[model samples]
Target: MIHDIAMIPMIQTQADETQKRKWLQKALNYEIIGTYLQTELGHGTFIRGLETTAIYDPSTQEFIINSPTFSSMKWWPGCMGRSANCCILMAQLYSQGKKYGLHAFIVQLRRFDNHELLPGVTTGDIGPKLGVNSNDNGFCRFDNMRIPRENLLSKYSKIDPDGTYHPPISDKMVYAGMVLSRVNTVVWAAGHLSSGCTIAIRYSCVRRQTELLPGGEEPQIIDYQSQQLKLFPQLAAAYAFIFAAQNIHRRYDQIQSEVMVGDISSLQELHGLSAGMKAFSSLATNLGLEVLRLSCGGHGYSQASGFPRIYGGATALVTVEGEYSVLMLQTARYLVKCVAQAASGNILPHSIAYLTTEPESNCSAKSENDILDLEILVNAYRHRAHRLVNEAAEQLKACLLSGKPQHVSWNENHMVLIKAADAHCHYYTVMNFVQYLQSTEMSKPLRDVLTRLCQLYALYGIDNNAGDLLQDGYMSGEQISMVTNQVAALLVAIRPNAVALVDAFDIPDEMLGSILGRYDGNVYENLYKWAKESPLNQTEVHHSYDTYLKPLLHQSHMEAKL
Candidate 1:
């Protein structure tokens, strides 16, 4: 949180030289702990609706910060409760009796001398959570806390001694920190899901179950066709998301450089891409990880399986920067605009140029092999996204035509709009996965295997959204069947190498922390060893058995006799 969320706003998009000298250097060096404090007890995802206030007092040249209501207290910041000494606080700025919108201010929470809460600042742990209890995801409240005017990290916007507000040229610049965080979320999703994938794949390879023939040895679970279906497409997805993250990371770096040089032209485009990818990657990864866990059967339900911890950390990405649905809608907003631009003969950005493609195109596949071609698969995904976006735009247009206001129209059509965003992101993932393989210099044998993975990813996606693909007659029912069959065939072809694919992820056993997924395939022995290490097992019988169990059992026996 300190590195990715807390200190990012100051270092990446704000904080002038003087501000850097004051706080940035020490923050970078970890001399003081920090967190990003934005979500309040009552508000999250809606940045503009935040209630914490930083009222500028010009006469004193200080800002009086207050969490005036219980709901206004900052909540859910990873380290705010006890670990952090300060935060990059998001509060509505009040200057000269005028609200100046949400702004980021570096607020000191604790006195550096002894690490005590500053005067008028009260903060503590938010208590145990569903997961990540080890992290002090804390809440904080301020009772008219005061900080010098210089404390406001002023790069995008600034205020004079007399409280004259000078806003940034682009209002969106204020959200640069969030864009960076969302981009990071994509990578985080891939990495965390990769861990779950690693554990589950290894376990599937080592854990044998059931008998194909009576009195025969059990087969490795990975040999099951159903297991392949569960794991392989998701394995493909981990790669797809990783490649997508790389693409966005490169774009972010380019746009960030442009921002540094006063070119805000691509910021919004980058913002939309990152938002959509963040939503896409996190959702796919979370859902895929859960699927992998379930495939592990009962053991997957245990904390010792490591899915619980991976899930706790990975699922946080869906809601941290912004909730997944909201983020997708933001991307959908951009997509709708692009569709209009395309209709007006405007040149769309390269990433979304597919919007301008002919929407009535039909699949050119006559056989399963034709549909399995990587190019054909990519085209299928692209067509689905293009059509989905157009339909969503038309839906919103119909609502507007029916006398609904823009927001109302948007609300009524949000589901389709979100679907559009989802389709666009899936297309982006498959598209990037293909392009990545094309550019890389891997060996031919490796490339063939990767191409198989990409085909599985695209076809699986197509199979899942078969109705959408069939709706426009883009793909006939026969073609859809071909896609489904191709997916199953790919699964069988990839099964022998499922463990190898996840092994390439190279997550260390220590990091994986899964007994069933250990490299040695010693699951049963390790399970016994791990169970013995439990604190309750230190004695032959737990103290609870003597204290409570004995009394309960004795009473029950006497009642039965009666």
Candidate 2:
């Protein structure tokens, strides 16, 4: 999967017959492991600002690599600590006294025979993290590291033996890998959310609560409207995300195919869409996992439940690939550009064409069936998102026209603009879900369940943005209540299928690695056995504890008598 989703377009250039026979084949055969190391302690998001330098020395016919400061040290590259023997390192390239932006260098960090660090290389493990601990993320410093002229991954940019430089066909091509990585992260988020929802939903079904009637047995927590409200919407979101994942993946694959054929027209759109979707999807999945965790009550807090680890792992994604807020701004910048282009009477791409249209104030819905229609709710969200984006753009334009600088205007209205971008992305996801369900390829039974989930997701989203829905007359106050009620009812209808639904995801026990979430329904027994394995339980007491407690008790008794 990682190889198939290589982010750096340069990697593709290097993957030709000769290079593949030499490097790629070895890596595929497990004779070598390589880390794509781009992030540094000082620079992560802003690749343009990286400090590591790679100078082309024509006399020696080598590239001299140096990490100029502690902050310039390579950080956060998976498998860099111990597993990787080579790495694709990003460094600022210098040749003939001129500086080129960040470029990739294939550097040998360890010997193939002994696996010892090479001279001029300082490296160590970054230690344990919140999750992804199995990946040996590492830190390294390069001091005057030298490699042959061919070491520079020159498919994109290169220096000849004479120290003359050649530019990449396109500057953005260098960053294509990172953008693809971001898109892959979006699909990964869907899988993580599905895993969490599956566990929570299955547990909810088996765990029963208070009896609903005098002679009735205690009902499954899934039967309660409140419980349904909490878990079912998340289940719905899980399905929605799965569908969105497929859409984004298809879009990414199409973009890759087009780029390979030298079509650069859609690069900017794909970059922005990938960034926005990754940010949106990861945040939603993170939040959804938390909801699933809380729905499980105190058990969710236990490590045995697996929610803690899953939640931690999922939440870190918001920061790792890119910080959520920062990535949202990337999307916002693209959105502003699209809005400007649309204002100039140009046709926008399909991904953002909604931004060009005027929003309607009223949407018609009368009966429960009408309100429950997923298309109707999705359309309502689309209109609301359009309205928000238009308003945000106007606010930004007004500030700019009043003589405020672009950065200043952006800073002043950053929150509103980001929120608008987020709304737009959410609407896209919901529409993707609706369209996916409408496809003939989908099974009828699966479609019915997914349709309910779509409605639940839309209603939950709308309730959160009730003010916009009301102000735009997308829904009346009473209609809002009716939708909310129907959403609640749908959750109840979905309860019986919760266990079966999650079961279909098929996460293995080894991968899940939780006692409470075990498949056999022996949570308490496993919990007890796990507790007994703790080191503290090996011995009943230490001599110090016994002596101190007995003395303290005797002293207390004598003092009381006195």
Candidate 3:
């Protein structure tokens, strides 16, 4: 889906016909590994602001690459520190007294013959991280490294012998990779959230707690309303994100196809959508994983529960392709632009038509039963989101007209405007989930489970943002309580299938790389085994014990005798 979208664009741009024949094909075949290297220690989420320079000398016809400062080193490219022989390096281009913006160049980092670092290339693994430590994240600096002109991935831009610059398309075209990467992140968020939900749900089912029913054995924790409230909504979010990711992917594919045919009209929409979706999905998944962890109580804290590591791995996405706040701003900027156009009586684009339109009468629930249906609930969210965005836009306009400085106005209203964009994106995600569930191709059981999950996700948001719902009169005091009750009831219903649900995710124990979240449930044994392997455990006692403890004891005895 959208989350895996980056693999295609990066692979296509970086690898040539010959390189593709030799390495890219093999990498695709899973024989070799590769990763895109764009973000540097000094700069992330800002492509135009990179410091690494690739100065092209026309006389020699080579690009001299340099990382002037320590911070300019490539820092977070997955599998770049090891495993990859090559990388698509982004560097500022300079030649003929003119400077080009950041561009991608395929650089050979290591000798394929012995897998040793190539000349003028300083590179090493970054070692462990918060999670996903198995992947070798690395840092590298170029020491006046020289590469041939052919190294430039010039599918969209190129330079010639005379030092003349030529761009096949707009500068935005070069940034397409970043957009695609963000879209892919959205899809990956769904997977990560699903993994966490599965583990938490299953553990909740098997793990027992205080009996709610008298004369019964201690009840499964899943039966607890609080436990269900915590997990069921997350399960719903997973399903919602899955559908959102798929929809985003479909939109991206359409845009990619159009781009290939020399159409650039949809670039802005794709950029906004992808960026917003990435921000929304990553943040939600990260938060959702934590919720899952907390739901498991003491077990979740144990590395054996697997939630902690999963959470860490998932949380990194907020900063990976793009920072969450920065990407949200990108979406916000686009939304504001649309609002401006609509206020001028210009038609809004299909991607953002929701902003210009008011909620349909059918959008709100008329009866108590309507609250339980996933579609109606999602529609309600969409309506609320639309209203919020429009309200934020109006607020911004009023501030501008009141003679406030543009930056000052934005800063003052930043929180609400950003939240408006967030809610709008979330509504889109929920709606996409509803549509995906209605598809004929889905299996009945999967559809049924996902439908419940979607409902839970929508209700969870409503419950969390109940103030918004209550203020808008979308839900009354009594109806809001009913929402809570409904959510609790669904959690119990989902309890029996928790184990089977998580099992369906097909994550290997090796990939999970956690002692707590092992498939076999031998958490304690694994934890003990892992602890024994630590360097500190290699010896029974330290030399310090003899030196310090013995001396202290002798002094104490002498003082007592005296």
Candidate 4:
């Protein structure tokens, strides 16, 4: 919790030098266990709507924290149940009968010596989830909990002993934690999806299926066109996300340095980029992992295959940090603003300069062979994204022109907005992939392999969303068919190197935890050996057979005889 969530907000956003020293010293020394508490039973993404309150008591120089309603009870915070003794909590601040917006405060939750719950604090584990159960995610509540006035994280917003208040430099700056979390999630998703693809691809190469020549040897499944279609795109996505993740993380560090100097001009753009990448990466990784799992056929269902565990952990990533749809909408809002600015001749950020330039009107790909060019594929993506963003913006304008309220217009057209965001993110990822291919210095053989992967990635993206490309007039129906053919060709070209590609990831067999994905490819023998390790097989399962099954069988036989 200290390194993952609380450390940044606590030290960078609010804590003064003295406060930082004290907290850092304790945190470093393990004198205090810490967690970040923001999401409540009722509020997940809406931080301003949190019902927990922190009211100032100038007379005693303290802040009284309270969970006024059950919904205000903090839920889903890791380590709050039994590990963390302190939390950086978000609560509504009130002073001198005037309400202040949400603020952060340091609240001690458990006693240090005996690990007992502090008075007025209530917490416990939330119970089993889809996965990650070992982390001990917990729920929490507070009733009239009092802490010294200094406990309020005051680097950004502060209250004096005499009850005067100082506001933050920017209201948006307060959400630094969310931005950091989202950026980190993009990197995490890339690595996770890479691992999952590694396991599934290696297993596929070893797991043979289908004797096309009757009574002949069954071919390895990795040789099938359908299997290549399923797994190769995922392989491409892992590489694409890795490239994008590196750039996003680099930009995040730059933003942090800029923020330290009190320059927040780039904060909004950074937030939008991180939100979109997080949404895109999480959604893609979740879908891609599941596809990889199913590509292995029936064996993928077994826990011993390692797919279930990878999929379970990836599923939660979609909902946490930010809900997928909500974050997509956030990116859509930014795109809408960008479109409006561009129409008025305003300059756009370097990442979005394509919006200012006219979209490619002439068809770049005249035939199936022409469609294989990287520049042609990128142009199609840019044009489609341009049209989608403009269309969404126009929908909003029409709604506002018809006298609908702003919020109502946005809600009614949310579907259009989110689709625009999806297209924009796809365009960004494709461009990043293209740029990396052209600029990166690498061996000729590695470059050749990556070039095919990038082509597959781009063409597959087009094939999957052909309707968007067609509807925007960026590609003809015939052109899309060509894209599909190219995808197939690229898949076949990538088949021989599939095992080698996965091998390059170099994941340890112990870390993979899959009998099917063992390095030596002795799948059938390992499956048997691994099955014997199950607890159910420890004593030949005789206890259950004698205790219930035999008795039931005897009773049934007697009734049959009668």
Candidate 5:
């Protein structure tokens, strides 16, 4: 419902206040169910490729909408399978045989009272998915459907009763809704990552493993350095992601403010930031959740452990909103542009200002102490990211210099380009985490714990991509080794606070729903109770035995006597 309402401002026009009011009021009051229908069978994230057509008929003041092919049918919209009676659709518009770009339109899909499919509207459920099955994801196709000319969402573009078309002042306004979704997904991923970390950490604190000393009782699994190594960093990352998301969301708000005044200078930057973080954050959380689940050993594989459902739901996000690789490339293209601007001495946006920085000869760290400094780490990351972006830009230039076409050059350098974008996003996220820690006021003990976690998050990022650091001359082999040791040491320091850290997430047990991760540490008892409550265990299960096994045994005995 919120997503549907959000579409209003994106396509709201001065010409159709009454139309906007009618739909907006219905949506807000739940008088009508609505959804955004952008993705189709042929197009998911790339909106430019949408194939649906809306041809205006000036004589009748109506637009004929049609899904010319099966691939043009709208797919993967929530509530469209059965619930949504209307949708905000993206379709190419044509007036007087001059095709304008894709525009939004309001189209009815179902009847309001009986929930029947409208004439010329075909829809059905898309069936079960990896997760979020309760959403009722649906498919839709239009067959020469005629809607009033007023149905064309004219906020950015409009048509008169005489069929004169007026394009929006800024075409970028068409995508504000999608940018909002991308930013929201980053914050959404943070919540899921925190939940998974909380469950795994709490369970590890209660689960015991082999004893470290002779004749001593087994210690909690959380005591193992390997366990801490897997869980603690993710705990820190969950916090880092929340901080990053907050920053991005705030920037989005600012972007919205600027857009209201017809200032779109920041739109491109916001798009790149949101897309990169959306991809990076979802992938990190998905991978982290799986690692946390496996850190619980065999219990993690069971549905009762709560990891499978969490993992399933999270994995679905990687392909939604945008595909991971595609978005990375989008950010890469933006980075390449930044490199070009920086080379010409043109001022760059603050997000990519690092591209203008020259790597300092003494940037490489000498000792573990120096490596642990937040300022040093941020500088190193900036240097490596700067080098990577420039390197990718150089590769593209090299390809083009060799006489390859622009598209061919892009294809050849795409792999390197994505890596560059990923590096930039990581650096930016760590910067956000570090800056948040430096600026916020808190108790000494809380601040100390957070600073350690922030360090862990930043260093872990550096260590994971140490090849980038080393290859870009930001760190030497010795320094990389020192980073490895520092990571181990941080794990030890963070071990004692693992439970406390996860508890700080404050996820309630009711929401967690894991037998192995309950707050009371009664895993075995809960498992037993769960088994007992199973339908199979409700009775002695003699019915199956009497129906098939007993008869089989009787026949076997008769045959043996013969």
Candidate 6:
């Protein structure tokens, strides 16, 4: 992940051509391992607030990097603990006695041949976490570490021999590289959510429990409506997120091409798009995995079921890239800008154009038949999102009008802003899901099943947000009950196809790492075999039994005899 997702992108986006030919080649050839080092103990999302300093020396033609305070030490960079020998580091720039803010630099962290930490650097792993123990997340502090000025990633920023700084052509391009990572995160996060969905769904189809009929053979748990309620919506979310991921990936490419040609107009739009995509996809998909895991009953709680590992990785997505709530606020800040632009009579970007025309006070799709119509479902999402965005906007305005400080007002209204951001992301997801289905042509069989999946996804979203949908008399209670019934019916309709649906994900068993989710439907036999392989089973009795259990039992017996 550090190599492909973070390292490669940094070099490709910011490294000079010569630096690229050297470092990029080494990265591609697997000759050098590296990770991104940016977030410090004191600051993460606020880049300008980072405390690490890099002061230039004109005589030596090098920069002295230091973590001046304990809180300034770099933290949470994956692979830096053990595997990585180098990193693209972010540090504050000082030259000609002027502070130039944050800039990226390529720093060799360890001696290449000996793999020993370089002079003036201290680094190591941060031990155990909730999940993803396999990854070596690490921390490092610099003690006036010196590097040649040439090591500066100068594609967008540069330094002159006399300790002068040259800024990027456009300020917006400074943030362009982050957009790529956020989009990649969207895809990576969705992949995990789907993995969990695939595991849970396949396991549900294979595992059998309670008998639904008197004296009849036990039935597969997939037949249970309650199980479907848990599994299908998550299954639907996996699909919705997949479509949303693809949409954002393609959109990133287009805006990236524009950035390459020096047109930075679309950069902010891309930033907001990628930020919200990463935030929402990671946050929602992680929750979806948890729901899917619980749906599997006792097995999901066991490490052997694979939720342990999958969820461990999924859980990190919310905090990395950017913390979910922080990114949502970033997204909401941009949305507020766009709303202001719309009110000024400017044309809005395609993604957010709906905000240009105010949402109707009441929903037109409250009826059962109209509710399921894909366009109406799309509009319903739009209405909820539009209202929430305006609500957040107006609330912020009210706070500002009440004479509070900007920072205080923002903090006071963050929850409302976060809700708006969430609603907007959900709207974008449903819109993308519907648009992808309509635009892409497929076999009728494939189309029919996807359409059903899409319907379930939309209705499930509406059902989940019934209160929001019903606000201002948009959707009535009777109609929401109908939505509940329809959700159940969709789950039943999706049951026969659940196995086939997850099968389409085409995840190999090796990647799944779960006996219960094996494709061959031999869960029980494999689970037994797996249990036998436990190290505790290697001995007839555990050593603790003799050292601890036997002594206690013997003591109890002597007392009883006395």
Better of 2 and 6 by TM-score: 6
Candidate 6 matches the true fold with a TM-score of 0.96
lDDT per residue for candidate 1 within 394-448, as digits (tens), equals 9999999999999899998989999999999998999999999999999998998
**Poorest lDDT segment (10 consecutive residues) of candidate 1:** 68-77
Lowest lDDT sum, 10 consecutive residues, model 5, at 68-77
lDDT of 3 by residue, 346-421 (tens): 7766658776666754435545567888767866787778777877888988998999999888888888788887
Supply candidate 5's per-residue lDDT for 64.
Answer: 93
TM-score of 1: 0.95
- In candidate 6, the residue pairs with backbone N, CA or C atoms under 3 Å apart (3 or more residues apart, or in different chains) clash, namely none
The top-ranked prediction according to TM-score is: 6
Each model's number of backbone clashes? 0, 2, 6, 1, 2, 0
lDDT of 4: 0.82
What value does the lDDT take at residue 81 in candidate 6? 66
Clashing pairs in 5: 12-155, 13-155
Whole-model lDDT for model 5 versus the true structure? 0.81
Off by over 4 Å in 2: 1-10, 13-17, 44-50, 72-79, 213-216, 540-562
**Model with the higher TM-score, candidate 5 or 6:** 6
Instruction: RMSD for all candidates, in order, please.
Output: 2.1, 2.9, 4.0, 2.3, 2.6, 2.0
Using all chains and alpha carbons, the TM-scores for the candidates as numbered come to: 0.95, 0.92, 0.86, 0.94, 0.94, 0.96
Q: Which digits, one per residue and each the tens of the lDDT, describe model 4 over residues 1-562?
A: 3343554455555677768877867876668877777645556444443478888999999999877334322332344566888888887889988888788787889888999999999877777778767666677788889999998777678899988888888877667776877887788788778888887888887888889899999998888888888899999999999998888888888988898888987888888898988999999999999899898788888988988887877887787767899999999998888988898998988677788988887557888889888899888888888888889999999999999999999999999999988888898898998899898999999999988888898899999998887775767888888988889889889988888888887888888888778889888898888888888889966688998999999999999999
Which ranges in model 1 have alpha carbons more than 4 Å from their true place? 1-4, 39-50, 71-77, 556-562
Deviation of model 2 at 344, angstroms: 2.7
Which pairs, if any, clash in model 2? 7-177, 8-177
Off by over 4 Å in 5: 1-19, 44-50, 68-79, 362-364, 546-548, 551-562
Which digits, one per residue and each the tens of the lDDT, describe model 5 over residues 62-151? 999887334322333344566788877777889999988778888888778898887888776777877666677776778888999988
lDDT of 6 by residue, 1-562 (tens): 5453577788988888988988998988778888777646567444443477789999999999987333322333354567788888887889988988788888898999999999998877777888877777777778889999988898888999998888987766656667787887888887898899889988988888888788988998888888888888888888888888898888888887887787777777888888888999898888888898899888888888999999988888888768999899999998888888988999987899898997666656555666667887888889998989988999999999999999999999999999998888989999999999899989998888888798899898888899998877877888788777778778878888888999899999999988779889788898889889999899998999999999999999999999
